[model samples]
Target: MAGTVSGFGRLNRKRSSNKEGKRKKAVYPEKSPTSPLASKLPRKQASSGLPLPEDDNEVPAIGSIYASPPIPSAPVSRLPARGFAGRGNCVDDTVADNALTASQHAPPDSGTVVRPLAGKPSNSFRDANKRPRSLSLDTAETPSKRKVTAFSEDAALVPTKIADAHAQVIADEWNEVARQSGVPEIAKITFINEIDHEPVPPDINTLFTYLDKDCLSSVEVPNPPKAETMPCIGRHPAFTDEGLFTFATDCKIIIECGQDCSAASNCKNRVTQLPRTIPIEIFKTVERGWAARSAVPLVRGQVLGLYTGLIISRTTASKLIGADAAYIFQLDMDEPQDADPSLVYSVDAFRSGNWTRYINHSCSPNTAIIPVARGSAHESLPYTLAFVATQDIVPLAELTLDYDPSEAKTFARKKYREKSRSKILKRKRNQTPCKCGTLQCRGWLPQM
Candidate 1:
């Protein structure tokens, strides 16, 4: 997020920095003739307080030096010094007295001149001068220093104009993404609450900001599908801490043939049922304090609730799953070697609801389920789950994934135990009733 600076404040700050640069440029004089003349001019004399002449032939006192015609000596004779008494006696009467004086005085044609020796310094010279004007080496904006320090200080701020331009480009890119996704209305995400020093956490509050009517948003994904009329299911599977899930759906499935089929026989039923256990082989560390959950068949990854978008892994899934703690599940994948399936629990999260009973028991679901693979061998690992949409989903539509891989009796028994155990425990603890109100709701549930 860009820093929070008022328009005028930013303008003033930019103006001040520009003025400083200009000031530095001005401080060192340049190479113009005037500057040279000023420097060359003899400074005030130490003994007489009179300005000294720069040229060798310039006479100190005009009146006495040119009192008479100049004296010319024999060709080899040395000229007599004229400052003392009787100094004129050695002169011969051939030379004009004013010749030397007139020749030594400044030429009449020199244009109206200001202080001499002042000119704009060259780039090299000005750069040298700027050294002292800049922050000290320990606190400066050298290339490396700029990268590190610019984040917090104006020393690093790109020129305000430059930053604004870059920001505009970013805004344009976001807008384009939104447009291509058929949700041009979402492009309004730019001017929400302007972030400053503090950062908003990746939670429901921050998520809600994207949905705020006043804020601008860009659709991060493209070509989302449309929804169909059906009895929308309300069950939301509890995503494991590792970000995996299993789900239940309210809609029924129909096959091309008369017989009921979970998926097209050609594609195989790999995606239809809940896998036994997702080996913890499909996670990757993307940054410090953050890892990504990857999907095998789709070859896509997500940063859990953070950036819910596509990503790639520098390290393989096994490396990622090995780093985190073990997770367990009741189902297992069809094959051990395949990278596809629903092992993306590391990238999933509950859409928010009852913390418990999030494990939706489904006999069959329209969506495909993948395992959260942690290790190659997969023993002693915890189960994580993830779901993919078989068809289009609408906003606020119930999201589900097939959780129960077994038959009805087995599925019901496991769910009954899980629900009753939690319910009895809640009653013993005198907890507030859960309000989910699912048909099979255990008479009480946890409230948000």
Candidate 2:
């Protein structure tokens, strides 16, 4: 998530930090610049007649500095530092200069034992001239001190989210799922929060099952005959004994000839056949919730991995999609097209899935799903897809895929957009505004 800052009081001020307190003490001069004592006194004794320390690092006890017969030393505090221009006319360059000069030159009077503040001295001080001219957008929208929080849907901010219902059950299940799937109990997720100080953990159910390999989802595989009729993309025992089938005749010949499925030279279709072993770290975001980033740079066109999840019937999908549409991918191909489109299949990673489940949507995506039919006897519709890099991706780059890949070609061409108006807007009525923050962002994730 992009950086956000909101909190009560002055976040920059440290109560225990004596140096910071003193430096920011410029909000008020020792005395009103208009005071007759301030104008008549020399710089060395100007700061409320306080016995200023010789070293700039030392802070005098905040009270009247001078004494003929030192009056009983008493405790006092300065509070005007919280607001930049809160003192209005009381603070000015003249008073601040006089105070600074006096504090620097005045020697400590041994008779008046002023207590030096505790803690390491900090040299930090604000520019004397710089003050808040007026509140800007940042100050205008600052959250109330009583309510500072980070939630999902900022679109570009870091990610996090939670719902109050069924908290315990969700947490238990989430912990079990993550533990079983080899996910760490805690990951060093780096994302700026609203306050960027205190952070609240997401509810127990915010994690994924962490699939290194594809696994069965809540919905089981179809019956043999019916499943066989469905088009298969890559090899899986559910579809075939050898678990190898493709749309390419050459690939079929090569793979059946006992070639290594791991090497590119051995099989062009091998990329999808193998498991995704790339170093991907799934981290929580400030506003986007959980997200994934690559640990290493990815070459353009490199096949990342096949998106896997529970293969559910359209009926099962209908019930779940309403709950959350982000992780449900429709899996249907024209070759094995169902007479009733509603009877088609979809993959839902919400309950159980791989790292790919954390990949979020981007209007202009870095990855594209390439449906590669294995080189089998005949071509079939791909039940799942392989995410291939559209461009060279840098390490730690958040991997994103276009939810609606069909919208790519029509981006620049008004003619194509006009022609495909029906197609583009087909899902518009059901979608939300896109927040990918790219220059070429289409303005909405039509399928978000």
Number of the predicted model whose TM-score against the real structure is largest? 2
Encode model 1's per-residue lDDT on 143-255: one tens digit a residue: 11012232345422432222223223323333333333232242222211112110111111111111100011111111111111111211232122232222221112100
> For every model shown, what is its TM-score relative to the native structure?
0.20, 0.44
Cα RMSD of predicted structure 2: 31.7
Q: Model-by-model lDDT, in order?
A: 0.20, 0.35
For candidate 2, give the lDDT.
0.35
lDDT score for residue 244 of model 1: 28
Off by over 4 Å in 1: 1-175, 181-334, 337-410, 414-419, 423-437, 440-448
Model 2 scores worst on lDDT over the 10 consecutive residues at 1-10
Global lDDT for candidate 1?
A: 0.20
lDDT of 1 at 34: 23
How many residue pairs of model 2 clash at the backbone?
23
